[model samples]
Target: MKTSPRLESALKKLYTAFHSNKLNPECNKHCAVGNILDNTDIWKHLSDHHGSIKLNYIGTVHQRIGRKFNGYSPLELLEIEATFLKACGYQLPLHYKNTKPKNPTDKIILFKGLSDVIRILCEMDGIDNVMDYTKLFEVKNQKAFYDIV
Candidate 1:
């Protein structure tokens, strides 16, 4: 399946970050959106706080003018961050008192966040989710379509 160059590039960066133990849900510079934006915290300025979808003045201006950062609009970047944080069990509009994972660096937790971010990225590009595995459980003639082993 063909994918946007931007999506391809973002996925590559995410994969590297996930495997290198650099992906962190709590850190702006190491989260899913951070990795896609080349591990930069500049995207944080798009919102008033972390894990928020509400765009600030600058973010609103950029979105109004259709400005894209590394191929995603300001709003889209915010959505990606929010999605990732949510998947990692973080409360919205992250705060010191908000609920968050105990082990933010756990590989299993990070993988879940990455999976959700990838799904959103694919959705943004109008493509099927590559991480979806439910197809393997499809039934045909009352039998499983694919072997689990």
Candidate 2:
């Protein structure tokens, strides 16, 4: 159950942001990757457009050099952002006229986005999805298998 230090740190920050109502998909400084990167907008420069998986010149250089920002590569960061945006109901390559959620700050909306990002994070760390609870519904020998503790 060991987690990477970088992943642990990012999860801690993201958890804090979620509960503090700081997670906002429309704001660069409050978005998923932004929170993981300490609410900094620097990661935005890694891509030419928001919600895009394509890396820019700087992002490509960093990825090619094997640089890690807050434990994620430049491309990984972009994927995280794109994943979050998509889960939040944003149109790809986010634009002012692009379709988006009616309420970007809604708890339900944010939760969905957070869930997807967490799955991606776990994948990046080669771990099981922490948010997955399907195991609780397992059935064994025609009996419900559950863990009470």
Candidate 3:
């Protein structure tokens, strides 16, 4: 899958933001690896204030607010992804989805969606590899992370 330049730049910026020691004044003294995992208060603060929440590919943003709603269709996912790409300053190719080969050889053609976006975020943050994390968003046993490879 071809990634947009804007997405690449965003990934790089997120990587630097997460790994730069200078950004966290007390990182060495107080914030250890285990602290991030074990501390509930710290985790809550990160989720609530740090924009750490991830979007769902299957569900719209409103569904994230605990409202019962149907998941996005494949075409809707494409539209949403295009919006995200534009927001990140990238112009996606015209008829991007239609450009795919008519006779595809791959048995499992993974559709890039919001899950892929979160995977990129996780990768940039050095939190977890795609395999360890992407399973959480998998539907019907189709692994999004594995599909990337």
Write down the TM-score of every candidate. Answer: 0.91, 0.95, 0.21
Which pairs clash (backbone N, Cα, C closer than 3 Å) in model 1? none
lDDT for each residue of candidate 2 in 1-149, tens digit (9 for 90 to 100)? 68889889988998999999999998999999999999999999999999999999998999999998887899999999999999999999999898999999999999999999999999999999888899888999988798748
Error of 1 at 40 (Å): 0.9
How accurate locally, in lDDT, is each candidate? Answer: 0.92, 0.93, 0.32
Candidate 3 on 57-77: residue-level lDDT in tens?
433334455432122222332
Predicted candidate 1 versus true structure: per-residue lDDT over 44-147, tens digit per residue: 99899999899999999999999999999999999999999999999988998999999999988888988999999999999999788998889999999888
Rank all candidate structures by their lDDT, best first, as comma-separated numbers: 2, 1, 3
Clashes of 1: 0
Winner on TM-score between 2 and 3 is 2
**What is the Cα-based lDDT of residue 58 in candidate 3?**
33
Candidate 3: where are CA atoms >4 Å away?
Answer: 22-132, 135-149
lDDT of 2 at 106: 97
Which pairs of residues collide in model 3?
none
